[model samples]
Target: MSTDTDTPGGDADTAARSLAHWSEAGRAEMEAFYALATEDYRQLALAADWPTVLRAVTHDGWRVLDVACGSGKFPTALDRYTDLSALPEASYDLLDPSTFSIAEARAQLRPPFSAAREFAVTLQELPADAGPYDVVWATHALYALPPAELAQGAEQFVRALRPGGLGFVAQATAQSHYLAFYDAFRAGVRDRTPYTSAEQVADALRAAGGDVRTQTVEYTSGTADRAVAEGFLQRCAFDDAVSLDQMEAAPVLGDYLAGCRDASGAYTFQHEVMLIWL
Candidate 1:
């Protein structure tokens, strides 16, 4: 695996600082991400939850680790699927870099719905007691990080897992349909990084000394109308670049939005979710 010294938005310090601060712009971006994502993503993500992955693992007490456990959605979903049997009284550590996301996860988790015991911490600094986890899960989080950080994060996951324990890292592939909007939005404005393919991710994990296997899961969503498109756009439009001022000035933005509003008045999207295991 080769490392790119020229970071995505320039220097490492700048990128780190930008990520660390969780500025209003960053929050806006997340909001946009959620908005544009929720409609299509919720179903796709849930569908990716194949029970065979969990059923194959046999551990004494299922201690789980959810890396980049944004809003605790996947963990919560897992709890619902496993129920009182097979996955009773499981422990979960939700690791993420954004305090905003952590806070959201905390707020979202409550009541009988909250079956798995949970905790939240940043990726670089996980709690000392978090480990020896039986099952490690990382879904859609690796795409945000650069190669070096991703490698380091993988090491952390390995360290947290017990011998013979299972670790699954789900990465979005380059062929995902959202790349259309993302690429067009970044064209001529800034250099936006694309997702690493499953093959590349499998190679990287193997190079990093993890026994790995890969699978590609394709998902397609039903067409969404103009209202849905607007909602999606609003949900994912964050930062000054996607702000009202920028949107007003960029003719392409209008064109893109119009294009999203198809002749049938419904927008369609497709995605490839890659599952890697160790």
Candidate 2:
């Protein structure tokens, strides 16, 4: 087995450049937005079925793979819930293409946790040595991948998992309330990637030879402050084709933000989570 990194798309430079401007300042801005957004990271963590999945793997030590594991948050959270001392010995592989994210994960990780490994490679080019993990996790990552690429990644995920092993693939559904907001916000923006619906994702998994189950997790923001709304808008306005000025100028942006802030002044968003087994 070899663990060579490959970027099948050959677009690492483009991706790195596009993400380079998102420095610590940008992260602070995004964190502020996350704090204000109707659906906070805490809610996403709780609603993501992490606890359930961990329970499933707690009995025997399981080699886990977290694809696009941002800031190592999910794995860290899993450690907290599973109680590292009581669980069987386990190794975690954190894979992502962002150097900044990998750095953050390394700094945040506690002892006994697996060392963070950086990969500027895409899912299609996952390292060959990652084979046959007991659990494969791709939470909130697949939605960012192109549909075709997502399918390819899913195939890789299944191949990497042992037979009867579990895989969790969470994606944003077309029916999500935030779809309208995202669509209007990215209107006319070139190189913008749209989210794939849950149905499309489940079908792709089935084609990849897995039995899949799905759930809808809904969350609402309880605050309607304009600063929060603007922050949310700014965090999402990172595509090369879309400028922050254009986003601010869009009439639809203001209207949609207002609509999201209900009588209580909170913005709410929804997402779909898919669970599969190979």
Candidate 3:
């Protein structure tokens, strides 16, 4: 959800391509991406008792900001895997650089997540007077955020929180599937910097003066369908132009994908995500 446009030190051409893919024209790519990526949200939903977590930070009129919210998958996952019927209604603000994503995420809101404000801006561009929210979260949403801007972005994130409020972020570490695979993709298929890592995020938050606590969640999502695997991998690289066969033939990426393939030829992606609380 954190588009590279506003991220300093990001690749402009790559950022433009990534930004274009989030539009209506790219719906197919989005769907294909979500086919396997939905597991990412489901896994996070099961990571904790979210209702309790929300209740712990809720107040009479508490508000929540979903940073770089992508199709509102986190709240949708909460609705699917947990009950939020008893919680007090809270205003939910959506923030993302993509208008399509903002609309998609807004449509997914339910009770206890009454849709309120919509911010069509990158994290670095978030208005200074925007929020003092009781809950702020970004679920696997900061991958495109440039390393140079992580500290500033983290500062804005921490600044948005109200006193005694809760802040949460979920991201893949350097060795996780998302990060590792992207590294290989850049090496074999493209030439780009690695995606931001969870460790970097935690350090940035700490630099912003946040007292961060972390939990690790490990899981695997696999598919025997080659189409699904291809779509998943293509989405992972944000390059639908590349075919599965091409990926399987690349030097570094080919070896990486082969390592993930089992005897049945199913591709299994291993994920290790960090759940950070501040």
Candidate 4:
């Protein structure tokens, strides 16, 4: 899960530093990240018939807002998995704190996902008149949102949707590899709070008066290539400074990685993601 939003809390400065670091990450670092992380979007696409789902809310001159749209992987996955030609054209606005990410995402858009507006701001800072969009989504995004700002972010998410409009968020649960591994990373390396979980997202949305429904999708992503696994894990933690050798030797994180490794030395990352509908 990639994050493009800022956090608000006692750790806000630390969070901002992390976001800034990610924004300035080199091209090679970003490419390495997506090498394994692209599966995140692929899995979400396989979870549903996206075209039919989007078509349900499609109307004349309809539009969608993609919150924290990092590299537009969700739309890319949708284009790959569905018949985009069958869906009517719709404007897709992107919102994110990183201009680099917004630009990368914008370049990936195609018909039915015509790139329209770009908002270089955090989700909480979305314009008051932003939208009553036909569809709003944050796929594999929002993990960096701190607990203190979740309520406000959730409210903004719900507020952006038109009545009967679709809202979707795909995130890993507390039990999933993403969340569990991050907790270990904090204990062993960073000493920061864990990334936000799907459970928390659902709770925040419900608390914000959203009618939320959830479904679970389980899978594993593995690699026999140590370099690939290393890149993936580093990106997952958003700290490339910590190498694979370091992670494998770390205390809590080392133990966690051992559990994910096979006798053949392959790494299999288990994922139990929650598909949330609002």
Model 1 has a clash total of 6
Error of 3 at 33 (Å): 1.5
lDDT of 2 by residue, 129-179 (tens): 766777777765554555557678768877878776777775556655445
**Can you rank all candidates by TM-score, best first?**
3, 4, 2, 1
For model 4, the stretches where C-alpha displacement exceeds 4 angstroms are 1-9
lDDT tens digits, residues 1-278, model 3?
A: 33353233243434455567778988888888789899999999999988888889887788999998978889999999999888999999999889999999999999989999989987888898888999999999998776667888999999999889999999999989999998998888877656889999999999998989999999999899999888888878778888999999999999999999999999899999999999
TM-score result, candidate 2 = 0.75
| Candidate 4 C-alpha lDDT tens digits along 154-255 | 999999999999999999999999899988987887766468899999999999889999999998888999998888887787777889999999999999
lDDT order of candidates, top first: 3, 4, 2, 1
Worst 10 residues of 2 by lDDT: 1-10
lDDT for each candidate structure: 0.55, 0.57, 0.87, 0.85
Q: Once superposed on the true structure, which residue ranges of model 1 sit more than 4 Å away at CA? A: 1-8, 11-36, 39-52, 55-60, 79-85, 107-130, 193-199, 222-240, 243-261
Better of 1 and 4 by lDDT: 4
TM-score of each: 0.71, 0.75, 0.95, 0.94
The TM-score obtained by model 4 is 0.94
Query: Model 2: C-alpha RMSD to truth?
Result: 5.9
* Candidate topping lDDT: 3
